[model samples]
Target: MSISRLHIERVRNIQTAALHQLQPFNVFYGQNGSGKTSLLEAIHILATGRSFRTHIPKNYIQTQQADALIFAQAHQEKMGIQKFATGEQLIKVNGDSIATQGQLARLLPLQLIDPQSTDLIDNGAKPRRQLLDWLMFHVEPDFYHAWQYYARALKQRNTLLKTKRQPTLADLEPWNQMLAEYGELLHSQRLSVLQQWQTFFLHDLQMLLPEIAVQIDYRAGFHPELGLANELQHAHSKDVERRYTEYGPHRADLRFKTALGDADVVLSRGQKKLLVMALKLSQIAMLHASNKETVVLLDDLTAELDSTAQRRLIERLSQLGSQVFLTTLDHVAVQQHLNDLSISYQLFNVDKGQIHAVEPTIYN
Candidate 1:
């Protein structure tokens, strides 16, 4: 599935723009600060119904504007042209006009590859855990409801612990029951997803970089048996001091490690980019295997990758056969790879937040 056309008004620097209907490989060329990333972010928002960049929805609105609008038309093989529209600088899917953000995500499934993804490897565990939960939510619809219920209960429980003058270990019994019940189900679902992802990632890694091995491990917040109350009891003092949740799956992490020695840990910036690309390719494979079509948004396709790794990544992306929207600054770079694959793609030259199709004088 791929977005055929997109209409944007008052989104960041893009006051008004229209991206002509796209294809298997759609490339956008422009200089830095020319809104390439913003364009890609718009597509990502439309697909996932959430900003992959900043949490501040207001930031998406133009400086003086109160609201922003993004309209898209996607062509799914089984389901004809699906039109989606959003109001007040929000993300929407299939024009259903849902009030909830998550409801929009279920409609336009997507996998994104951006420079920020390196955070998953070098930074905190939140990003990696989010990846797992995102995939799980798509697979299990009811999981979202369970997640919401648990989040509400957890918030109330934490608030009580913080404000109650006489905080006791036993006071959390009721909340613990609710938290444990939902947490267990969520953990079980995540474990199943991780198992499936392990196979997918291993296979894709072999194809993309056979010399290296990759593994993903899930570490829960605490032992399942301790229950929420017992865990809270153990951390009562710390909780009182911090006045917030010091422990829970929310604090858990997904660890990525290699069997290779520690000396192999030092990866150049470019190598880190390649590793991130490999993971995204693996995610696309998993999404495909699940019988789902995902719209892929790639920001600055040639940023830190060496020519060889770039070619390899492009080839793998092509094999995935999903509709891709990519941005780059090098004309020759895009031409060489697109020619190598002998695939016809649409080219749009972006300038001052506007996009226009550029025709090649000759075909290779």
Candidate 2:
């Protein structure tokens, strides 16, 4: 959803702020420690109902503040959250109260790239699997329900195995059956989405990081030769010993490699940034194909790019046609390149805790 209006209070350094007349592109520029990044972080909270920068909600509220709030209207739907220091929060979507984060996430489809984005490549497969699941959540309508079932069944199965006394196969039969049913659904959905996206996935990857030949393959955790039921049947005793189901879509990964083979950690920082950006672009393409619009929050997009790389990146973003909000500590250096792209934009200055909208800001 593309948010046309935003209301924020007691979030990070900003005590009160509201933005209207939001445009396709937004640039929040200021010097270091001027609260520029906090503005973007606030937008992120509105979209996903949480901050990508930190997991500690209390860390975000202004000091000496007991609560924080963020609300926005997007695609004619109402969404927002109010967080209290007592470890409680309320979420609203489409003017109705929402309890789970998934409910809020379903209302907003968003992608964020920050300095920590490189972790997508350098970290474990868990993060990579999450990135893929985000696509499945939006691409396939039945994914969420199927996923909930699978997670519940997996939990139940694990609980059976963790008893003080080791449980027998008979004890695990029901949950194993449930897990098998929904696990395969998840696997199938992810595989189909990736297959459909392969052509353009590689195209965007190669275009952005041309020097490296990158490849991504789906690794469904269990052996392909075995059916879910058969695999679970065969591993029953071992899983009982391990106290957990060892194989399923939960352990799946998008294996990334290069021409030289297995380039997970070998890519340079700049190259990794470009590759991550490319992946986000591919996701944007997928959303566009499905007739959905996403708000892209880019933090410090110019950090590692040279002049030419910077231009190419901005041009690529312009072509995507999504609402964008990006921040930078230096504005003058990026102004000319933005002008060359001929994209409409709104520029604002961030200082202390205030956001001042620049007048006549849309320069085409």
Best-fitting candidate, scored by lDDT: 2
Lowest lDDT 10-mer window, candidate 1? 77-86
Off by over 4 Å in 2: 360-364
What residue pairs are clashing in model 1? 4-21
lDDT of each: 0.72, 0.81
lDDT for model 1, on a 0 to 1 scale?
0.72
Error of 2 at 160 (Å): 2.0
Model 1 residue 134 CA deviation in Å: 1.8
Please report how far candidate 2 places residue 227 from its true position, in Å. 2.0
- State every prediction's TM-score relative to the real structure: 0.89, 0.94
lDDT of 2 at 36: 76
lDDT of 1 by residue, 1-364 (tens): 5677788777678888877757888888889988888888777666555577776667676776666666777664211111122234333344344566675566667888887767767777788778777777777666798889778878977898779865665776677678777877777777777788778788777766677676766787766667654676687778767777676777767776677532126655555556666777777788787777677888887877667777877777777777888899886787688788776688888888888888743336
Question: Which parts of model 1 are misplaced by more than 4 Å?
Answer: 76-96, 225-229, 260-265, 360-364
Which lDDT tens digits does candidate 2 get at residues 1-364?
6778888899888989888878777888877777878888887776676787788888998888999999888867888888876768888887788778887776678888888888888888998898899888888899999999999999888887887377877888898899889988888888888887676678788778887888887899887679787899899889878988899989998877887766666778888888888888888888887777777888886787777877776777777778888887656556667777777777788888898888533335
